[model samples]
Target: MTGAADRVYAHLGKWAPLYVWLLVVLIALGRTFYLSVNVSNSLPGKLFLVHKGAMPQLGDMAAFRHAGGGGYEAGALFLKRVVGVSGSIVTAKDAGAGFRDYFVDGRFVGRAKPVSRSGEPLKPGPDGAIPPGHYYMAADHPDSFDSRYAAVGWVAQRQIVGKAYRIF
Candidate 1:
């Protein structure tokens, strides 16, 4: 009911739709830019500047360009553990084809799982070698769609936006 509140509400009402449309356009542009940048994977980081849904596709290369929250989006920045990297050997010890943890340089980093709707497992099979120029990453959560799955297969070194710094 105050003058400032009234002015704010009127301004929002007039441009809410336009603002939303602008956001959509930006997202589309970002997606396109990412697609152009990286030939594989989903957007680098989360889109919309706000993460509020299940894991998104990791194929977007531009999305990964962000190092932390200060880049473009606004959210809690997280450090992604490097479970597997280029030329690293990995093995999934399971018969049914499910998620599993990944190791790098003989150190446990994180687990690999599907982060996309395809639900495909990471390639190279158990005890396989990761090709050069590709970096495999995974989250701490088992259910997290990580490098262990195919939907997000191997994350190219060029697609890596930033190394995990610290949890905010």
Candidate 2:
């Protein structure tokens, strides 16, 4: 019995590292899967992490692939708040401070300049209303690259990854 106990201990000692490594791998894969299907605003700093599920709604912070027209690199993921959903009226008007104020459903949310930092003209939203199956996204940051510019006018529903909920 003593000899058998010794053999078992020796086997465990030899395989302990392998067991630990396997556990680490499993944990990493689990985390990766979770993050892939989730939204994280913690890239620049640890702000929040949220699960990715269901269609995004108005006022929900969302993650999406950048589908903008020019100057934006392809395959980039962006985080912004959904200010306007389908059928929501969005308008941009000169705010008289060298910026254009953005309004959704007649409520002012934020502002954007008429020119890019590089001196190129930045086009505002269309004169008509927002179309169906589209969203107007924005960030509170003054220099955020969002739907206020012609490059990122309106985000399609299909481009949205998930809605965000603050985790921390």
Candidate 3:
């Protein structure tokens, strides 16, 4: 065993470039495979809640894709309910009107569209209709970003990366 180990070491020292090339090739292939799996599986990605982008935005359906950075290492994911879509009209005032009032198209629909909180009917005005392709998502928290922020208002369906099922 000692002799064999010595011979292997001698050969490796003489041909170091070959070993280096092999390592590089392996690394590249590994990275490629990982990326392919991620794209196909929609592998859960991590999102860092930036100070500005911490709050969820409108058009946010599921909570898979994140606004901030941190690729595939984040653990916490946020889930904001969908409130409105594209083309829909939002109104500033009506029933249950809060600080964030919206008007979709020309109608005054409730802010919460598809899903309602506590199984209660959404407020009348202070609402916004969703468009066909676009969605209006918002967090239960009033201060949350959801559709309210000028920066991340109304997320496009095309932009959505994936749907989140679990938090852990």
Candidate 4:
């Protein structure tokens, strides 16, 4: 009986480790980390790796869920830089012809457009100090539809999905 049990256990051991590893990878891909491809040229790089367990911080690329605006679908995952966190100041300056320059903590971040690529009208984002539990997301891309426009607005703390890294 012992010999028979040993044979069964050895047979199971050959495939059990592989099965455990596969399950771990599956769980990590969806809950712990994920890979996303950039369809827009917002902040450079074509591929991004996001760690869902990490907290977002100022100056880091963060992944968040879009609340739907400017032709974007609700719940869509977006990656942008955290330019202004809680208590940071946001200011806008005229850049001529209905365009505006956006600044965070006195540093110029982006220019807000008056219209979208499909000819839809666009509204500039708000100015003044950022509220708690919110962040101003943006980048140096002149055409990025980020927090520089009212369409995207300030990203709420609940909307943040993860911290992202541009992985090319």
Candidate lDDT (C-alpha), each: 0.46, 0.71, 0.44, 0.89
Ranking by lDDT: 4, 2, 1, 3
Q: How close is candidate 3 to the true structure, as a TM-score?
A: 0.36
Off by over 4 Å in 1: 1-79, 95-127
Error (Å) of candidate 2 at residue 5 is 40
Give the higher-lDDT candidate: 3 or 4. Answer: 4
- Which tens-of-lDDT digit does each residue in 74-164 have in candidate 4? 9999999999999999999999999999899999999887888889999898989899999999977778889988878899999998999
- Give the lDDT of residue 59 in candidate 1: 23
Q: Between prediction 1 and prediction 3, which has the larger TM-score? A: 1
TM-score of 4: 0.82
lDDT at residue 23 of model 1 (Cα atoms)? 76
Candidate 1 lDDT tens digits, 1-168: 699999999999999999999678768755332222222222233332322221223222112332222122523222244556557776664433454555555666455443324544344323467777765566555444445555345655555544222111
Question: How many clashes show up per model?
Answer: 17, 0, 26, 0
The best candidate in terms of lDDT: 4
Please report how far candidate 2 places residue 150 from its true position, in Å: 1.2
Which candidate, 1 or 3, would have the higher lDDT against the true structure? 1
Across residues 14-124, which tens digit of lDDT does each residue of candidate 2 receive? 999998996786576554322332234322333434444446788887777787555677667777788888888887787885788888899886788877678877777
